[model samples]
Target chain A: MLTGHRTWIYNNQPVIISTGTVGGPFEANGNIPDAFDILHDDMWLKQSSFEKAQRTMMEEAAQIAIKNSLIQKEQVKFFISGDLINQITPSNFAAKTLDIPYFGLFSACATSMESLALSAFIINGDGADYILSGTASHNAATEKQFRYPTEYGGQKPPTAQWTVTGAGCALVAKNGEGPRVTSATIGKVVDMGITDAFNMGAAMAPAAVDTIETHLRERNVDPTYYDLIITGDLGHIGREVSMDLLQKKNIDIPEEMYRDCGLTIYREGQPVLSGASGTASSAVGTYGHFLKLIKEQQVNRILVVATGSLHSPLSVQQNDSIPCIAHAVSIESGSDNQ
Target chain B: MIFFWAFVVGGTICVIGQILFDVFKLNPGVTLTIFVIAGAILDGLGLYDPLIDFAGAGASVPITNFGNQLVHGAMQEAEQHGIIGVVTGIFEVTSAGISAAIIFGVIGAIIFKPKG
Candidate 1:
C-alpha cells in the first residue's frame, strides 16, 4: 500500500529467501571476504572483456541465489537487474543467460534497492511468485566507460571512489522465511550542481539524505526505528555530509547506527581513496554482510538507502552536473512476523 | 650528463602534471591540453628549442612536444607557402606518432583482449 507520495508499505512483507554475492580479487581481500558466496581471484573471470566478466558474475550470482533457495531456476518468475555499463549491457547479457522474464533497470548505484523494492512490491501484489533482484559492476569496465581507460595512469583525487568489482543477487518469494521487506521509499533526482565526476559521494549525498528523511517522515517512524540506517556507496565524504545534513534536519540517527555500505566493504589502507561505489557496493554489503548479521540476531532492522549518481560520461563531458537519487528499503528479521 | 638532465627534466614535467591533477583538480585531458598549449606558446616564443637542445629526448618526449612540433611545422611551411600552409603543416611532424598510435591500437585490438 502507498504510505505517502513516493513510499510503499509492503503489507504482504515479501521475504528475501536467499541471496548470492560474488566478488573479484580486490573484494575478496576486503573487510567482508567471507560474506561473498563466490570470490574469483581473477578480475576477468576467464572472460575476454570486462563487460563479459561482469555478465558472468551476474549470472553466477543469480544462479547461486537460486541454488541456495528451495526453488529451482524455472520457479523464478522474473529477473530484475542492472549495472553501470553503457546501455546496461552486462545486465542485458546476463538476462539472456538467465532466460527469465527480465526487467532491466538503471538507477546507477541505487539499482540494487530499486530492483528489490520493485520485487517486493510485485510479490506483495501477487505479480509473481519468485523474483530475482540484483546488480553488478566491474572496476575496469566502469572506469573505461565513465572516467578513463583501466591502464590510464592518471592520479585520482582523495575524494574519488573505487568502482566495486562484484555482483549481488537476492531471491525474493511471496512466502518464505528470511528477512522481510517492510517498506520502501523511492527518492527524487536531487542535484546540487556538482560537476566533478570524481567526487560522486558529495554529488550523491543530498539525494540520500532526502530519501532517508522522507522515508522516516512518510513511514511515521523515528530514525531509531531501524537498528541501522545504511546508505549506499556514499563513501567517506558523502557519509559525513549526509550525517551532518540529517542532524541539521533534527533526524537524530546515532553515528554508529548510521553507516555507509561504501565504507563498510573495504578495509583501511586498501587504496580505495574515499571508499567503494558501484551498483554492487550496497548490494553486496547489505545482502552479504548485514543480512547475515540480521539472521544471526546481531542486528534486527535495517533501512538500506541505496544512492546513485545518474550521470553519463557524455553528460559529464558536456559539463552537466550529476543528478543523483536514492531508494530506501526497510528489512526486518522474519522471526517477528508482526 | 645529458641522460641525467633528460631524466630530471622529464621527471619535473611529470611532477607538474601530477600537481595539476592532484592539487589543482585538473583532469588528465585538461592537464595534457595545458601542457600542449604551453609547449606551443614556448615554441612560438623560441624558448622550447634551447630547452630541447639542452634536455634532448626529455624536452621532446612529453605531449608538450606534440604542440611544439605542430607550431614548428606550421611556422616552417608558413614561410614557404604563406597562410594556407599553416593548416596543412600542423600534422606534418607529428603524423608518424599519430599514425603509429592508430596502427598499434588496431593491432593491439586484433591481437589481444583487455586484461582485467
Candidate 2:
C-alpha cells in the first residue's frame, strides 16, 4: 500500500531467500572478500571486453542466487536488474542469457535498491511468486563511458570515486527464512547545481537526505528505530554533508548507527579517492556482507538508502549539473531466528 | 594503397596496446602514457618522422601523435626563442584540443539537463 507520501508499506512482507555476489580482483582484496561467491583474477574475466565481463558477472550472480535458493532457473518468475553502462547493456545481455521475464532499469548506482524494492513490491502484491533483482558494474567499462578510457593516463581529482567492478543479486519470494522487506520510500529528484562529475557524492547527498528524512517522517519513526541505517555509494564527502544536513534538521543519528556502503566496502590506503560508487557498491555490500550479519543474528532491523547520480555521458558532456535520487528500503530479521 | 597502410599501422598499434593490457595486465592509463612517451622519445631522436612519412595519418592521428606534436612544438620554439619558449610552445600545439574540450564542455553543461 502507498503510505506516507512516497513510501510503500508492504503488508505481505516479501523475503529475500538468498543472494549472490561476484567481484573482480580489486574487490577480492577489499574489506568484504568473504561476501563474494565468485572472484575473478582479472577484470576481463576471460572475455574480450570489460562490458562482456560485467554481463557475465551479473549472469553468474543471478545463477548463484537461484542455486543458493535451491530453485531451478525456470522457477524464477522475473528478473529485474540494472547496470551503470549506457543503456545498462550488461544487465540487458545478462537478461538475454538468463531468458527470464526481464525488466531493465537505470538509476545509476541506486539501481541495486531500486530493483530490490520493485521486486519486493511485485511479490507482496501477488504479482509473482519468485523474482530476481540485482545490479552490476565494471570499473573499466564505467570509466570508458563516463570519463577518460583507462589507457588515457589522465589524473583524476582527489574527489573522484572508483567505480566498483562487481555484481550482486537477491532472490525474493513470498515466503522464506530470511530478512523481510517491510517498506520502501521512493525519492524525489534533487539537483544542487553541482556540475563536477568527479564529486558525485556531494551532488547526490541532498537527494539521499531528502529520501531519508521523508522515510522517517512518513513512518513517524525516529532515526534510532533501525539498528543500522546505510546509504549507497555516499563516499566521504557525501556522507559528511548528509550528517551535517541531518543534524541541522535535529535528526541526530549516531555515527555508529549510520554507515555508507561506499565507505564500508574498502579499507584505508586503497587507491579509491573519495571512495567506491557504482551499482554494485550497495548491492554487494548489502547482499553479501550485511545479510550475512543479519543471518548471524548480529543485526535485527536496518534501513538501506541507495543514492544515485542520474547523469549520462551526454548530459555531463553537455555541462549539465547532476540530478540525483535515493530510495530507502526497510528490512527486518525473521522472528523465527530469535 | 595509403588507406591500406594506414589501417594496418593503426591496427598494429592497437594490437600492441591490447597485448600489453592482456599480457602485462597494464592499466589502460599506464599503457597509453607509455605509448605517448615512446612516441615523444622516438620523435626527439628523429626516428618518428620516417614512420609518419611511411604510415601517413596512422602515425599522426593516434595519441602517440600528441606526444610527437608536443616535442615538435618545444623543439621549434627552443630554436627560435631559447629556453623559455620550450615550456610555452608545448601548449601552443595542444591548446586547440584542450580549449575546445573545456569551452564545449562548459557550453554543454549550461544547456543540458541531467536525465535518468
Candidate 3:
C-alpha cells in the first residue's frame, strides 16, 4: 500500500529467499571477497567482449539465485534486472538467456534497489510468487561507453569512482524464510547544477540526501530505526556531504549507524579514488555482505538507499548538468511467516 | 645527438601536457586541444620552424605537428593562389594521417574485440 508520499509499505512483506553474487578479480581482492558466491579471475570470463562478459555475470547471478532457492527455474515467474550499459543491453541479453518474463529497468546505478522495490510491490499484491531482482555492471564496459576506450591513457579526477565488475541477484518470493522487505521509498530527480563528468560523487550527493530524508519523514521513524542506513555508491565525498546535509536538517543519524556501499566494498588504497560507483556496488554489497550479517543476526535491519546519476555522455558533451535519483528499501531480519 | 634531442624535446612537451592536466586540472581532450592551437600560433609567429629544425621527429611526431602542418600548407598555398587556397590547403598535409587513422580504425574493429 502507498504509505506517505512516494513511499510504499509492503504490508504483506515479501521475503528474499536467496541471493547470488558474482565478482571479478578486482572485487575478489577487495574487502568483502567472502560475500561473493563466485569470483572470476578473468574479467572477460573467456568472452570476446566486456559487454558479453557482463551478460554472463548477470546470467550466473540469476542462475545461482534460482539454484539456491527451493524453487526451480520454471517456478521463477519473472526477472526484473538492469545494468549501466548503453540501452541496458547486458540486462536485455541476460533476460534473453534467462528466458523468463522480463522487465528491464534503468535508473543508472540505483537500478538494484529500484528492481527490488518493484519486485516487493508485485509480490505484496500477489502479482507473482517468485521474482528475480538484480543488477550487473562491468568496469571496462562502463568506462569504454561513458568515458573513453579502455586502452586510453586518461587520468581521472580524485572525486571519480571506480565501477564494480560484478552482479547481484535476489530471489523474492511470496512466502520464504529469509530477510523481509518491509517498505520502500522512491526518490525524485534532484540536480544541483554540477557539470563536471569526473566528479560524480559531488554530483550525486544531493539526491542521496533527499531520498534519505524523505524516507525517514514518510516512515515516521527516526534515524535509529534501522540498524544501518546504507547509501548505495555514494563513495567518500558524497557520503560525507550527505551526512553533513542530514545533520543540518536535524535528522540526527549517528555516524556509526550510517554506512556507504561504495566505502564498504573496497579497502583503503585500492586506487578506487572516491570508491565504487555502479549498479553492482549496492547490489553486491547488500546481497553479498550485509545480507550475511542479517542472516547471522549481527545486524537486524538495514535501509538501503541506492543513488544514481542519470547523465549520458552526450548530455555531458552538451554541458547539461547531471540529474540524480535514489531509491530506498528497508529489509528486516526475517518474515513474520518464517 | 639528434635522437637524444628528439627524446628530450618530446619528453619536455609531454611533461608540459602533464602539468596542464595535473596542475591546471584540464582534462586530456582540452589539454590536447590547447596544444594543437599553441602549435599553430607558434608556427604562425615563425617560431615553430626553428624548433622543428632543432628537434626533428620530436617536434614533428607530436600532435602539435598536425597543427603546424595545417598552417604551413595553408600559408604556402595562400601565397601562390590568393585567399581560397587557404581553405583548400588546410587539410592537404594532414590528410595522410587522418586517412590512415580511418583505415586502421576500421581494420581494428573488424579484427579485434575490446578486452576487459
* DockQ class, candidate 1: acceptable
lDDT of each: 0.94, 0.89, 0.92
Residue A169 local lDDT, model 1 = 99
- Full ranking by TM-score: 1, 3, 2
Give residue A287's lDDT in candidate 2 (0 to 100).
Answer: 93
Write candidate 3's Cα lDDT for B84-116 as tens digits.
989988988889998999999899889976555
Worst 10 residues of 1 chain B by lDDT: B107-116
True contacts kept of each: 0.33, 0.00, 0.42
Q: How displaced is residue A88 in candidate 1, in Å?
A: 1.2
Task: Locate the minimum summed-lDDT window of 10 residues in model 2 chain B.
Answer: B107-116
Interface RMS for model 2 = 13.2
Better of 1 and 2 by DockQ: 1
Candidate 1 lDDT tens digits, A230-300: 99899999988898898899989989999998999999989999999999999999999999999999888
* TM-scores of the candidates in the order shown: 0.93, 0.76, 0.91
Quote the positional error of residue A112 for candidate 3 in Å.
Answer: 0.3
lDDT of 3 by residue, A150-171 (tens): 7675788788999999999999
Quote the positional error of residue B52 for candidate 3 in Å. Answer: 4.1
Candidates 1 and 3 compared: the better one by lDDT is 1
lDDT of 1 at A12: 92
